[model samples]
Target: MRRDPEPLLNIKANAEAPADARPPGERDPYLTHLGERIRSLRATRGMSRKDLARGAGVSERYLANLETGTGNASVLLLRQVAGALDVPLPVVLAEVDGHADPAGQEGQGGHRAAEFSQLVQWLAQLPAGDLARVREAARHALSPSESRDARRRRIALIGLRGAGKSTLGRALAAAEDIPFIELNAAIEQEAGASLSEIHSLYGQAAYRRYEMRALERVLREHDTMVLATPGSLVSEPATFNLLLSRCYTVWVRTSPEEHMARVVAQGDMRPMEGNREAMTDLRRILQARTPLYSRADVSIDTSGQDADSSLRALRAQLPHAD
Candidate 1:
């Protein structure tokens, strides 16, 4: 009943070699070689398969298959695995290339070519607006002095309900000696209605329109302020991109457990009503929105950390703060 162990070979180098130059049976050395490199790197770092798998947000069995050269991982999966392993994907690819040819030049070219392909694939997935905003942000971050004449500093704080945006925004504002603005409060005051009433009477689309109006007003009125935004803003791409273009966004990240506890402490068990799957749903939502959250300029893990500690971490990451 024993299954055969997976074959280990250098598949990457063989693929790069000219058809006439490749040895017999050396079909695909790149993939196998890459897998071996990953395994070796993980081992060298004293990380177990399970540890690497967990860090990569994949199953241990998947990591096992990959390490044994049986799994053909996608570029995205490879990137995640590389991030978890604390090695750039190109470095891993280069290592594979090195194993293929002792001289190393041939493999280096292949690695660079593969990395360029991966970058193109990633850029293609982003929305046009998001991509443009990212480029602008990168340019500003790289050369602040050049951007200073037209660069208006804006900070948008985003997180799930009860993730402490309001509390931390106030602390951050105090620390920076800047104004703290609750965007929802501004919306409510402008509309002469509460958020729940607006959502209940007008629906989500209408509420978003109102939110956009409020955001526009804020942008025009305040040059620099810490703005707390709703978590569901991700669902509105246009509005989200507008905010991103105009501000340096920070995701006040919290664990599902911490979010649940905070909501419960506030006596709002509405999220848990009649549904045994509430906790599961919350976790799924958080996981799904992580990519959007990661687009923020900075992410601070506020779970189990006090407001002051969170504020300090935020301050440390910001470009210029008191």
Candidate 2:
């Protein structure tokens, strides 16, 4: 049995594009599946292709091409897509990664793997000079660094908005005599406006760009610091992964009641002033982010704990903090 090509004729980049604009063809199944996954994730996030394209720093046409399965993307481009989509790269590469498994572990399309192994073995038998040249070439091909991938000296506090990340992060920094950074504040400084203003002028996609750049600058300039991140940062997997790669992230845990109370006590009544569903939405958001927050290297329950006690507990988890 053969299946006809799936034409994504209904998906348009903009209102100006024709509804029938999708080119018709039965493309590679792997590419098609990957494209479909990307499209589906975008839809779930309530983002248009243009938004994804902008966040990924790719052109709208390229994004359209990718979503249609006609594009043969490089590893770098795939990474950009993963970042924009806020997913691990492996998710986008799942089907192809399995069938094209480099380790031959999937039991399919492994001739190249076996041949490459043989080539490596044969090279091992060669002279020292030849081996050195081959090793350099392999290094070039690998282009991976353990040190760059190593977790950094920074400590990051992650959780919901009113989870006490800012307070605890600052205290931790003060105790250790390290600098403290609030990621959203850094973003706000870079944008020269409030987060709401930035979002109003440039959308979430642009705000994420600013966030990434600000974090990059912080990491580059500071050798060690305590960073308090935005609650929703977990939604951006790439940025979060980068944080995990370079920082000991801690989940600042607190109860919903405490969260709302703290936000209100801080005089930011925006959470419950006008919006009737604010508390429900906050609950939903916290529930949704719990799994992601759990990925942190450490956790400190700030609920029912004062500033000094919470800071002491957090510091206890950090090496050499005591």
Candidate 3:
């Protein structure tokens, strides 16, 4: 026999209850339950509300309300929140249904979309050459203005290696008629050392000092320019936050397989030549950095797409980039 799907329940507080019947500052039980579940999952993952909001692409205020039993989060929002908490969607829905134990319900957790969210979380952690692509995506998400107005809006692209920040950035700049600058090149010129040499001789901390100086110089000198930045900029939270505060940010992304293919096609075998466990390391690095990347204004998936297509797609989305 074909069984009907579960009905969506409307949860509301009783209007007929006596004034004192409800505790002070108490909300509807269902809302309170949802809030508790969100808080529980967040605590279990060792994430603060801010961390959860960033990971889920929602605002911290919204998350706070959801946890405080005051906000009526939609189904889609609940799913995103659940995914960010790394819990199964049904686990959240089950709580809503008054079933604390999901294991007791048959096929309750069989939602493939929830499983797909897990896969996305796993893939989001993988690293490859697509970090630059994410930067380009961020840039493309912003508005492109002509005339002097273009000079007023500041933008920055930050992501991982091989994410195509430079390549796509130039195209975006040309389309918008704005100047394009390679942040790494600017850093090398300012420090008088190549990135590899800086990393090898002075270490990451030294390189970051040079990178920050270069970023400040560019931000001060050029009011309007498409900036191509290194992916590791995100590792320095203070610096990255400063850059983000000064400009609109974008994140370009792609699948691990696509990232590997692009790097191989570019004749860059550094990742492959290193440890055999490079892919695993890449995944861990991306996972650690994804929260930073999610802070961008826009995200684009550049997998299997050409530069023109990616740029055009990004331009369409960018209000000022038009």
Which ten contiguous residues of candidate 1 have the minimum total lDDT?
A: 143-152
- Tens digits of per-residue lDDT for model 2, 1-322: 7743532222232223322234556465556777776765554343456556876789999888878877653433445556677655555554332254566465544554445545655764699888767755654455423353234468888887788999898888888888999998899988898986886678787888888888888878776899998877877766776677677788998998899989888877442456576676466657666767887887889889999999889988875532
Tens-digit per-residue lDDT, 1-322, candidate 3: 8743532222232123332234757676657778877765544332445545866779999998898887653454555557678776655654222322456643534444446556555546657557646655554455232333443365567666667777888998988898898988989998999976886676556777998899888988887788878766876755676677566677877776666666677876443455565565455556666877888778777878899988987676565534
Model 1 lDDT tens row, 134-182: 7667645653242331223777898776688888889888877888899
Colliding residue pairs in candidate 2 = none
Relative to the true structure, how large is the alpha-carbon lDDT of every model?
Answer: 0.69, 0.71, 0.67
Whole-model alpha-carbon lDDT for candidate 3: 0.67
Please list the Cα RMSD from the true structure of every candidate, rounded to 1 decimal place: 14.9, 13.5, 18.9
Candidate achieving higher lDDT, 1 or 2: 2
- Highest TM-score model number: 2
RMSD of 1: 14.9
Q: How many backbone collisions does model 3 have?
A: 18
Question: Which candidate has the top score in lDDT?
Answer: 2
Error of 3 at 14 (Å): 63
In TM-score terms, candidate 2 sits at 0.56
In Å, residue 245's CA in model 3 sits off its true spot by 1.2
